[model samples]
Target: MVVGGSLGGLAAAHELRAAGADVAVHERSAPRTPAHGAGIVVRPDIEALLHRLGVPVEAVAVELYESRRLDVDGRAVREEAPQWMTAWDVLHRVLREPLADVCHRLDGALRRVRVEGHEVTAEFSDGYTAHGNFLVGADGIGSATRRLLDPSFRPAYAGYVGWRGLEPESRLPGDLRELLSGRLTHFTSDGMQMLCSLVPGPGGELEKGARRVNWVWYVNVAERDLPALLPGRSARRSASFLPPGDVPPETAERVVREAEASLPPALAELVRLSDPFAQPVLDVPPWRMVADHAALIGDAAGTVRPHTSVAASKAFGDAAGLATALLGWTPAQPLPAVALEHWEVLRLDRLVTLAGTGRELAAASGLGVGAGRTFFTGD
Candidate 1:
């Protein structure tokens, strides 16, 4: 059984099935792509896993021929940093389409897990129970499975937040679009970094006029101001993230004011023309990733800062590793404890290394270690 049917959970189920395990994925919400999403730069690990799953990345992705650093006036110094980019929705669709009817049980929100000897069971809030020989927790950062294993788990907010948005290509000002096309652009200033690149539009439309420009601006924000920035109707719901349209009007206005003051002209215009959202950058160097018959994968195991560009790759690698460990274990068989233990030992070390790399990158950029004014408690 797999808990939390996001990218990690879904990938785990797919890989495990290929390894000859009968898997059931339990997701709390309806299976749908997030409306407020960001761009993804395809990395090697994820590219390999997608190919293994027979997905043609080129068909769903856009290519950026160069990486350019821009001045506040929109002047550029270009380099040959070629990359393939895709929208989060497009990739999610590709991964999800193949599992249309295989093993998804939507609305099955996991509430508890019970382990009796070699058997593992998942209990859902909806009063449902599922039994399996082994359980994988691919649930995201706020994983209930991880919490069950270690109640002290908390994601330390890296004193900043990313303001992200998507602006339609057709709507961009003529000169701005001409300058940004076919390039990934970035600008850096005191306590802030912003980047913009072209990505496939809604429905994976990559044509010239149908694409979208995705941008992310990272700014240092004091912890005390979080409640004001994240004013959701329900405090708990918007503590960590505010999806697209949910960003409060005043917060959005403040973002525009800040953008005009800090960003390059073209980049600020992109922010002005888009409906922006905010998500606190967070990290947690996981102390433990496995316990008996259950193991956490993806963000559940370790929350790494996105500066490493390995967020998705690490999750996919975890899925591949877990599946490989269960390669010879067939359906209705006893749990492969020894194989799991070996995988856990290796996985723990790798998770630590990855988390450390993220921290190093964040610190060099002046944003990772003790970056925030206060630790986020999700109050």
Candidate 2:
């Protein structure tokens, strides 16, 4: 059984089912449509996992030929390898179709989990219960499974917030669109940074007027100051806890105004037009990745900072690794402890390093130009 029907849960369920296990996914959200972030960058490992899950790579937009340019104060500094960008909805739409045959119970929020002997019982908020040989919590950072197992674990704020949004390519002026089209561009200043890239829409074409631009801007803000930046009831919530549509009009305007004043012209315009969403960056310690019958994957396991763009790939990698371990499990047997340990070891170093690099970038955001080279080795 996999709790939480988001990307990690879905990927876990698909892998387990492919491994011939009787897998059932329990999602707390309604069954209508999947809720996801603005955009996701798919690295090679994620692409490989999709291939294994029978998802065609061609169906998703691939921005392989273009490069990611890093700039500071409007001056080009560095360039990194190409990356693919796709709307989360588009990717999920493709992933959902293949998993239609799998057993999924939506609106089934788990309230408690009881592990007795070799069997595990999951109690849901709706008063229903299900028993399975092994339970997986792909539930995300606030995982019920993790709470039941280890209440001491919590996400640690990484000292930064990422503001993101999407806009139509045509919405951008011609000169700005030309520079941003078919490429991932970054414009940075001291504590402020913005990244813009184009992704194919429903038509799967990049014709001058055909695609949409996805943008993410990272800024360092104090945790105490976030409340004043939110809208309505969310104003009382912490930066790490704010949900979608929580930014107040005044706060939103402040964010856009700051971008306009500090960022480069092309990048500033993207933020100006963006309906911004903010996420207080955080990372879970390595030890938090382990539990009784389940393991954390993606942001649920821990976030490696967006600087490296490795979160999605790590989640898909976890799914792939976990699937390999459960390939021959029987109903009477337990999941292999050795396999879980192996996965943890494989992921720990990369995550820790990325988190450290993210902190470094956050601390010295004003350094500009040469700063991008310190964390990212490419270009």
> Using TM-score as the measure, which candidate wins?
1
Model 1 steric clash pairs? 159-372
Summarize candidate 1's per-residue lDDT along 78-126 as a digit string, tens digits.
Answer: 9998889988788777887887767778776778888887788888888
> What tens-digit string does per-residue lDDT give for candidate 2 at 174-240?
9877787667777666666677777766455545577777777776665455555544444466535
Ten residues in sequence with the least summed lDDT for candidate 1 = 370-379
Kindly report which residue stretches of model 1 are placed more than 4 angstroms away from their true locations once superposed: 31-33, 233-237, 331-334, 369-379
Q: Per-residue error at 150 for model 2, in Å?
A: 1.1
TM-scores for all candidates: the values are 0.92, 0.86
**Pairs that collide, model 2:** 190-365, 190-366
Cα lDDT, model 2, residue 24: 86
lDDT, candidate 1, equals: 0.79
